[model samples]
Target chain A: MLSPLLSSSIKYYLCFMQTVIIGSGNVAYHLAKAFVLNRIPLAQIFGRNENELSKISGELNIPYSTETLQKADLYIICVSDHSVEDVSGTITTKDCLVAHTSGSLPKEILKGDYRKASFYPLQTFSKSKALDYSKIPFFIEAENEEDRKILFEIASKISDNVMESTHEKRKYIHLTAVFACNFVNHLFARAKEISDLQVIPFDYFLPLIDETVQKIHEIDPKSAQTGPAVRNDTRVLQLHEQLLQGESLEIYKTMNLSIKKMYQLP
Target chain B: MLSPLLSSSIKYYLCFMQTVIIGSGNVAYHLAKAFVLNRIPLAQIFGRNENELSKISGELNIPYSTETLQKADLYIICVSDHSVEDVSGTITTKDCLVAHTSGSLPKEILKGDYRKASFYPLQTFSKSKALDYSKIPFFIEAENEEDRKILFEIASKISDNVMESTHEKRKYIHLTAVFACNFVNHLFARAKEISDLQVIPFDYFLPLIDETVQKIHEIDPKSAQTGPAVRNDTRVLQLHEQLLQGESLEIYKTMNLSIKKMYQLP
Candidate 1:
């Protein structure tokens, strides 16, 4: 009841602390822009290359640097896989809270005397496309209770869906994502390749692709499964194998057999 | 110049002959509705089961059959794969055209004296969901030029994207579809199962799922690939493996290794 002075002091403290982004890649750029849109001051963005940093700096109208890391409330490392260790090594902060924007990397890698955490945004990012950050899920992991709360608060400010996922769980989720997204796209690319070889337009597969994705919202995949492999239509499958004679044929047969085995088709 | 009497005779022939579908599954129901909506009176839906047949018959107000196959210019067998041979066997007419709605099955499997063909719609179907068949790609294969022309005419009546794909090409396309659609859905299901076990809400993953599909429309998937294995963060990957230790662990390792190999990640 008598904490009027403390409340005003806390409000002033919050208004002054700035958030800094320490990378210029897709995740970092998107996160920084979201922060800026939320009216949070983006203190500085750092990159190894001035040219890359200039692109993001020009787009967001934020300050850029190719210099050494400085003390900030939060330092987010969003470099590539091979660059993570080296990037973290170069940062000089021993007291500031540091985090990496990675799904699979442990927060411990970024651990120094400072607090370590992860702010992994679980979405694919492209520079040309403006992402809907509110729909993206941010996986937060932090060292202590206060840091965890801070990370969650920061993530919640930008995204509606924020969860505390461990490094292990996020990794497993990432692996499943590769199977669900990346590999599926590869299959579509293969379909496009073969279709193009026969002078068939790639747009022909778009409707099928859209319908297939939409089907899962209604039924479980196992029950919704179709095709010759599931039906054990050997004659048709053999003809397909004959037509795709070579590496493409091998890929086709392997996938067919996998589906057949999964469905217990003869 | 064509003769006036010959043109009048052709008009007379077209007025009497029509396409009739023989099954009440997803494909037949949707195709019949599309035909009726397009002002084409060519759908004569037949089903062996009374309940399924009556359901579609009641909705479309089309003629339904449970015991007999009525004479039609074209009969499209849209039954289950196991029942295709039996249905074709039952409808043995020397001169009537017969086709099966299957992507994998060869046209010759109808094996009747009738000019057999395939009118495979390359898309997933659900009974409860209303599909816009005009957007669906129809792949037609026929025994002769006249049959091809007839099938093509029927396909073009509802859809703009129609192709004359051989049984072999259709089979390969069907196989590729399994990898692209069915397998991807399975991965999502598995992710749901894991999230359920962890007491995480299933809706949390929906945003990730939606974004993954959306990213493909922007760029090639190989370049858009993300996650732990691609990032080569071994520590996080090992932690994730440890978390998923059970039947799911095998799936986790296999998918992770596959992604790593695909990306040539160290």
Candidate 2:
């Protein structure tokens, strides 16, 4: 018969195992910090950039490296879109579960002599702002049953919202994210530029921005769309076009026309 | 010299006079409710839509109307884009401070044979959701000196951030708001559609959306932009195109190319 003390000791040993994070970018930095804050031991952080590695290590008080991938239960690969495949090619962890944190790239990118998976945090990140990972959604994808279970277990520890998704679905979600976040932000920047040039206070636009966002939380955006474009107020549109005489004007007209066409509003 | 009893009565009467709101659209509804909550009495609400007028009147316990403009200290015209001229055309209240709530249309749209100005709330409004008017910016404009002061005083009663802007400036601000709010929301809707089609939970994209907006408060949007397009990850871009297909694919490619060209990212 097994002793109760021995069984308890085994459980404790398993719970104390370290987690390794590969690649040192925004996602990696935020994830590592969250793990450390949660008191989960961060075994190592591996990457090519010594400066970034050092900065992350110093900030989190975690170990850093520009060396080979360390053996751990899980190794998270966080890198740029192009760098994913190249970095995956370097890791030789056949037994350890390896995952990449990318929205668009497929899990096949990690195809090699390894137990591969994905732990995509569906969010934008910046080095300047500290993220609340608990609020972030984690999308987990794996090749097999056991690996998938392990990946889900790990992801669930940090975030409240965790789910299993295939690469095809994740890719579609990523494309949508590009439109929603990146493209939308670019639109705001363009708007800011136009407003600044006219010497108008940018704060004037914030109310509209806040309302536009708040509206969709309650209604469909198609039904929620409002503007001179939606109304096809030709006189106002023409007057606006005349005022904004540049590249931005062209963009404005194109977007306005698109909105009008979408809604079939004149 | 005035008698003490008569002077005290007049002071009490002036203090008890309530501000009246004209028209029962989104702006009028929100403003009226806000005024009521602020303990500023909403003496009356007027609109052609009897159902809407009665609903607001009943909810706020204010008087309802489908009648012509009555004598009031302030008259705010909150109507559709095309109706601004028609609605204000009949008013001949030279003594009353008159204003219109429109971003694109000028204050002169209310240039009846009266004191004309604008009380344009720089925010989108829906009939369903209650808005915090204190957070919403108010743009004040007037044709003459005395009317401008009255407009400013009325606006200051609700919002803290009030500004004097020209018609040309307000028009440009409205145009910029189209990009920031309406256009951005369309992109979000597009993203949501794609994600829904792919069977991914819409919640997955919320983190990304929240972060992108939060980042803007910290840094310039030009610096905050991220994703495969900004990084010039052509491989991921091609894969994204393959996944999107048809018009969405075209939109994805066009936007990606535009972002790449803007940043000169490779």
Number of the top lDDT candidate: 2
Q: What is the DockQ of candidate 2?
A: 0.60
TM-score of chain B of each: 0.89, 0.87
lDDT of 2 by residue, A60-115 (tens): 99888897667777778888867888888887766667899998778888856888
lDDT score, candidate 1, position B40: 70
Evaluated at residue A107, the lDDT of candidate 2 is 83
Interface RMSD of each: 3.5, 1.9
TM-score of chain B of 2: 0.87
DockQ for each numbered candidate = 0.38, 0.60
Q: What TM-score quantifies how close candidate 1 is to the native fold?
A: 0.85
Model 2, runs deviating above 4 Å: A1-18, A245-247, B1-20, B245-254
> What share of the reference contacts is kept in model 1?
0.32
Q: All models: lDDT? A: 0.72, 0.76
Could you estimate the TM-score for every candidate?
A: 0.85, 0.90
How would the docking of model 2 be graded?
Answer: medium
The number of clashing residue pairs in model 2 is 0
Candidate 1 on A217-242: residue-level lDDT in tens? 66665676766666677776776676
Which pairs of residues collide in model 1?
none
